[model samples]
Target: MAVPLLGEHLLFTLRSPRLPTHAGQVSFPGGVVEPGEGVVEAALREAEEEVGLKGVEPLGFLSPTYSPQGFLVQPVVVFREDLPPLKPNPEEVAEILLAPLGELLEVEPWSEVRLGRIVWHFPWRGVDIWGVTGNILKAFLEVWREGKSPPHELL
Candidate 1:
């Protein structure tokens, strides 16, 4: 999920060292949906739990992406006029990062063929956002830049 903060910045989280997978990696605040929870509900709940973010309006959902680790992720876009003070959960989140959207857009994506497939990486500061997160951001920027939906097949 993407959280648009005040000043057009995007919110991200650094996973805690205690995480089983992707530990210490940078990602948007989100997790698996529970049996009775919807995508938006799961996204919001995770956001609040991981970063103490609240009172955001749901903009829309991006295309679902399948992770290499065997999970489907739905990127939910949300907006807030301003962000509240954050208290990151130590167990799930190590730190909260607010990155400017324009700066992120300007960074060139690093790509290479790995295991017979192309993988893209976006390095922001010291965080390397790759895998599913990078793909989602690429798709979001593509739509934002073109001002139209991406190819349905691409989604």
Candidate 2:
């Protein structure tokens, strides 16, 4: 028998007062791809290193995306058999916020908010989740809604 997979993807927010590159905003658990690492491996490794999630089994790869910084990114869709309670690394993550995929899909188009030089939304939290990570999530949700795959670069 195939084990049932949870339909909702966990949307976590990093809690760090000092803004690294995209600081003081909401984002997924990911970062720069390391040397000689594939996209999925990088994602899983980042997840483990930043959020203390080890041995996460990646289900599939979505698509290759280019970050605003010019490096190519791959969003890995993964599942952890048992999500050990999150222990965020202070240097990378401060807090872990769990967002249900269903809620994100059901959410209305985010009400726009402007922060410094950028514009996005704090639709879920009072925090703005923008940048490349936000784009990836938006694209993923779009594909989930359309019932057909969309090109990664579209987002």
Candidate 3:
């Protein structure tokens, strides 16, 4: 997954409502890694394909995230000096959402119990960013708060 930083904000996507699965949900730009591809390479490729994001530099890797669907997601952190005009692929993405990193850190997260384990939600623009995406964001924020992990350049 590509957890992209456009300056001081993070980028997320609202999946198209027409999609069969995970439709209308918020997520990072990602997909299953292709055969022979490295995790970071797959993340960069997926970001470009789903969101028309190009030329962003990969900063580093975050810890692997586990999903309810039984697969581990290897997350790659990426950065851009300035956000470019983003074009969402209509078949997969509905809208692109940007959240300032500081704002996300300040908002408290609500939790759910149905997933057998606690799952969290961070509200933004009236949509709940929950499930794996939320988990990923939560982890990233924790690391950022510790003044480590994302590399000094992000600070």
Candidate 4:
């Protein structure tokens, strides 16, 4: 998965309700790696395909993330200083969201027990970010919690 950061905001996609899985839910842009493509390549490609994002530079990679559905997803960080116009692919994306990274980092997510496991929900605006996407964001925040800088060259 590619987490596109524009300055201090993170880019997210609202999945189209017509989709089969995770429909109408918010998540980062990502898809399966192609025949000879690497994780970073797949991430950038998926970002472009799903949200019309282009020319972003990869910043770093986080630990592999696994969804409750048992899919292994590699998370990659990408960034662009200036805000870029985003066009959502109507078939896959309903809307594009820009989340305030500072607010997300400052607020603690609420949690609940679900299926014998603790699930966290990060509230933003009027929406709740949970499930796989929530887990990914939570893990990413761990870096800051540990007082470790993210794999970045420059903002």
Candidate 5:
């Protein structure tokens, strides 16, 4: 799912740099749910903490994707009716970038470099947005383009 922005769709980015797992990578601001938090709550909470976005109205839950690093990440889709200007916490996020989803949907503009059996490349900037997060986005975009949900395996 995507959010409407100025007659187009917009997606937020988390600029994570100098880390162990996904250092110097650009990603959506989310992580695994904590002990007591549900997927919806965790998604909203993480978005707010990682990037100071407020009043996010969660539309519904999407397919949960599995991370190779052992995270079962539920993609909770949301819409920001009155979103506050973002202020990313440097400890967790270095920068926040907004991209038009319509632009991202144009697959012709992206190159898919195959790494392994399941590791195909979708390059954006110097960072490779691959693996679980990239898979989720790929599925999401397929759904958007085809007007039907792809057969997603549960994580």
Candidate 6:
């Protein structure tokens, strides 16, 4: 999930040391959906749990992507009127980074592995964002740039 603040910045989290997977990596505040839970519900719940984020209004959802680990991730875009004082849960988050959307938009993919495969990396502060999280940001920016609504296939 991406949280857009009033300053045109987006929120990202550094994974906690306690996490089994992707520890210390940069990611959005989200996790696996539990049984019987919808994607939006799960995203909201995880955001609240991991970052104490509240009062956000959902803008839309980007196209879902499958992780290399085989989990389907639905990226939700949300808006906040202003930046909130975040209380990150130490067990799930190490630090919160607010990146300017303009900088993110200006970033070119760091590498192109194949004809259709491009690899992106965004380094904010000292942390690098890549892999699935990077892909999510790239897709979201594309949709935003085109001024098109998020794909209806998202749910």
What candidate 4 gets wrong by more than 4 Å, as runs, is 113-118, 145-155
Estimate the overall C-alpha local distance difference test score of candidate 3: 0.87
lDDT of 1 by residue, 1-155 (tens): 55444446778888999999999888888887889989889999999999988888777778887665657788988777666788999999999989887888898998765554455789989789877777777777776667542222222
> Residues 1-155, candidate 2, lDDT per residue (tens digit)?
00111234454656477865766566677776779977667777777777777655566666666655655667776665444566788886778777666677766555333332223343665655656556666666766677642222222
| Candidate 2 Cα misplacement greater than 4 A, ranges | 1-7, 110-122, 146-155
For all predicted structures, in order, the TM-scores are 0.87, 0.73, 0.92, 0.89, 0.75, 0.84
**Top candidate when judged by lDDT against the true structure:** 3
TM-score of decoy 4: 0.89
On TM-score, the stronger of 1 and 6 is 1
Residue lDDT tens for model 3, 20-87:
98999999999999999998899999999999998898888778878766568888999987888899
Writing each residue's lDDT as its tens digit, candidate 4 over 22-119 gives: 99998999989999999999999999999999989898887886676768888898988768888999999999999877788986698776555556
Task: List where candidate 1 sits over 4 angstroms from the true fold.
Answer: 2-6, 113-118, 148-155
Q: Put down candidate 6 lDDT per residue, 1-155, tens digits, no spaces.
A: 54434347788888988899999988888887889988877888889899898888777787887655656788887777678888899998998888887888777656444334454676655667776788788777777678653323222
| lDDT of prediction 6 | 0.74
In model 6, how large is the Cα lDDT of residue 24? 90
Q: What is the lDDT of residue 69 in candidate 6?
A: 60
| Preferred candidate (lDDT higher): 2 or 3 | 3
In model 3, where do residues sit more than 4 Å from their true spots? 149-155
**TM-score (C-alpha, index-matched) for candidate 2:** 0.73
In model 5, the runs with Cα more than 4 Å from the true position are: 1-7, 81-83, 108-117, 125-127, 148-155
Location of the lowest summed lDDT over 10 successive residues in candidate 6? 146-155
RMSD each, Å: 4.0, 6.2, 1.9, 2.3, 5.2, 3.9
Q: Candidate 2: minimum summed lDDT over ten consecutive residues — where?
A: 1-10
TM-score-sorted candidate list, best first? 3, 4, 1, 6, 5, 2
Candidate 5 lands at a TM-score of: 0.75
Better candidate number, 3 or 5, judged by lDDT: 3
